[model samples]
Target: MLIIALSTNIAMLCLVSAVLQIVLPNDAPQWLIFGNIVVFVACVYYTYKAVTVWPDEEKAATIS
Candidate 1:
């Protein structure tokens, strides 16, 4: 659940960055573009992990 929420938020950030890229002038700073790419990659990784490697609540409960 937490991963889901986090990935969702990251996805939202990626969306916002994409929108900004489209709306803002082409002269956006290099760092901003790099940051957006980094965020997008992170979002993809988290989303993939969430889908493929879900946490086991039973194991989590046992550990706690």
Candidate 2:
């Protein structure tokens, strides 16, 4: 649940950052754009991992 919430927030941030980059291509700082991209990628990877692992976690809980 926490991870889902975090992913949602990060997704929004990425969307906003992308829009800003498009709207202000010349004004947006390179580092900020790079940082946003890194964070977005990380968020996507972790979210996918979490989702894949969730079924295992549920099975473990049910067995216990």
Candidate 3:
């Protein structure tokens, strides 16, 4: 659940960054775009991990 929460939070942050990048003027700092890209990648990774991995309880159930 914590991983799910983190993934959702990261995804939401990425969406915010994307909206800012689109609505903000081009004169916005280049670093902001780079930061957004980094954040987007992080969100993607977190989402993938959250979906593919299991919690302790889940793993124990699977083993039995």
On lDDT, the leading prediction is 2
Give a tens-digit lDDT track for model 3, residues 1-64.
7777887787778778877877877677777777777787887887788777755887799989
TM-score of each: 0.58, 0.70, 0.63
Candidate 1 or 3, higher TM-score?
A: 3
lDDT scores of the candidates, listed in order: 0.78, 0.80, 0.78
Order of quality (lDDT)? 2, 1, 3
Error of 1 at 32 (Å): 0.9
* Residue-level lDDT tens digits of model 1 in 1-64: 7777887788778768877886888877777767877887888788887777875889889999
lDDT of 2 by residue, 1-63 (tens): 799679968967986886689677477777878888788888888888888777677788999
lDDT of 3 at 7: 73
The residue pairs found clashing in candidate 3 are none
TM-score of 1: 0.58
Model 2 CA lDDT for position 18: 69
Better candidate number, 1 or 2, judged by lDDT: 2
